[model samples]
Target: MASTVVVIGGGYGGISVAKALDDIADVVLVEPRETFVHNVAALRAAVDPDWTERIFIPYDGLLTRGTVLRDSAVRVRPTAVELRSGTRIVADYIVLATGTRSPYPAKLDVEQAADGAAKLRATRAELARADRVLLLGAGPVGLEFAGEIKSAWPDKAVTVVDPAADLVSGRFPDEFRAELRRQLGELGVELVLGTSLRELPGTDPGRTGGFTVTTGSGVEITADIWFPCYGAAIDTDYLGPELRPARRADGRITVTTDLRLPGQHTVFAVGDVTALPELKMARAAQAHAQVVAENIRTLLQGGGTLASYRPEEDAIVLPLGPKGGVTYASEVGVLGAGPSADLKGGLFLDMYLELLGAVVAR
Candidate 1:
């Protein structure tokens, strides 16, 4: 009999490993969402309704032999998984890939694709009515949201306030930060870093209403709408006592270089849920999936050698709207707006659509 492999959470990493193992193992992928959310495009989706429809791809065509279970995992054991609906799945091997959760517009907080798309449309409508916007974080999501908003509505006043003292932290070079500030300045997006709001705005985020907020430094700012772009946490609360000890204080699961849980040979983890010292991005998740798949494949073949994963050099393809942004890699250092736009302008929707076997609409 073939080995039964159960993959929890059908996010980027989960789907990649499941598809890679479907032909060899009895792959079972469990996910809660009705459709795969291409959250990389979510920022643009909030500004353009056209992208909302394209970002949510159905899982029907993702696997030929593997099974995709539309259910949530309530608990995961060493060799089995218990679902919220009381179904227990026995497996020869298990993979944990439950990714992190971010604020809306960066990541839709809804389960169903239709509901998420509807929410984006409603938020877009609300955004259309606002003349001034306040974003409460200066991270990638916040900056990306500001860029998308400015791209859609250039005349609108967009201010990004963060308690962090620098843009994008000190991860990138000073040159990169300067270039980022330069672009934002050109787009008329204001940056108010090193300070936080004294209190949240009275109006709910994504809702259109006039509200005034004071910063920690006693700077008053008024905006017609606001959004929170921070506070992303990994989703791993369902691990049972047997496996819970492997989780770090930050909620990321500790895995070996081979991507398997230490001392638990048959259990593995990947993506943002892993305690890897790397940026939590979709590309990194997929890379983790590749290593996990290879290791599992070796084990299935009577275990010759296992593959290991190493953190890649810091790289980012951040897009400001569709035509502007920056790209940075260890090899290239940093490239200007033209390269960034060409690399991720369309948010790689077509590539992901092809990977999911969805027909790309022209």
Candidate 2:
């Protein structure tokens, strides 16, 4: 009998691994959403609501041989997974791929889709009515959002606020940061660095309204709207008491070199669920799929050596809207509004999504 592989969380990592092993093993995928959401396109879709339908793809067409379970996994033992609907599935090898969570609409629950759509529409209307826009945080998401807004409405007064003393500090070289500042200036994006918001101004966060925001350094500024852009929270409450130590101080699971839970070789973890010392991105989840599929394959082919998974140190590529962005490939870091943008913002996103059997026809 072939080995049964039960993979939970049909996100980037889970789907990739299941597709890779569907032909070789009896693969079972557990996911909650009816469609696979191409998150890279979600932000852009928010600007052009017509393209929103394209970002959602039906998972039925992804893996022909694998089984898809449109349910949530509530418990995971060494050998099986218990679904929230009280369904239990037994497997020879188990993979825990339940990733993290982000702010609403971008990566929140499906039920919030209506709220997200309404917020996006309101934001667009607000942007049309307002003269200035303020964004909190300089992370990739915040920067990308600012870039998209500027590209769509070049005349709008756009300002990015971040407490970091330097933009993308320690992530890029001085030259790159300087170039980014120049580019933002050229785009009329006022960047207020080294300033922290003491309190969130009371106003329609998604609407055009007058609001005053105070910074940590006593710098006061007023804007029409503001958004909080921060890191995501990893969801692991379903793990229960299987691996107590898996939850690190930062609330992430720790995996071994082979991507398996330490001391529990039969069980494995991947994607945002693992406490890997690397940036949490969709590309990283794809990389995890390669290691996970290979390891599972090795386990099924009798006794064999398993390849270890090592995350790249400086693999950061940020696409800033549809025309520009930055990329840090190992020691070489390149910053511009062209190379990174054209690659990801233009065509690469669609290509990557198509590769995963999810694409929106333009």
Best by TM-score: 1
In order of appearance, the predictions have TM-scores of 0.98, 0.92
Give lDDT per model, in order: 0.90, 0.76
lDDT per residue for candidate 2 within 1-362, as digits (tens), equals: 67889999888899888998998888999988776766766666656666556666668667877799889888887888889889999889888888988763356456334545565666567677877788887777777777777877888888888998777644556666776677777778888888888998788555678888888889888888776666678777777576666778767889999999888878888898898988788888889889989988888888599989887665566656677777766555674666777557653556556656665576
lDDT of 2 at 140: 73
User: Which residue segments of model 1 deviate by more than 4 Å?
Assistant: 360-362
Model 2 segments more than 4 A misplaced: 105-108, 111-123
What TM value does model 1 have? 0.98
lDDT of 1: 0.90
lDDT, candidate 1, 189-233, per-residue tens:
999999999999998889999999999998999999999999878
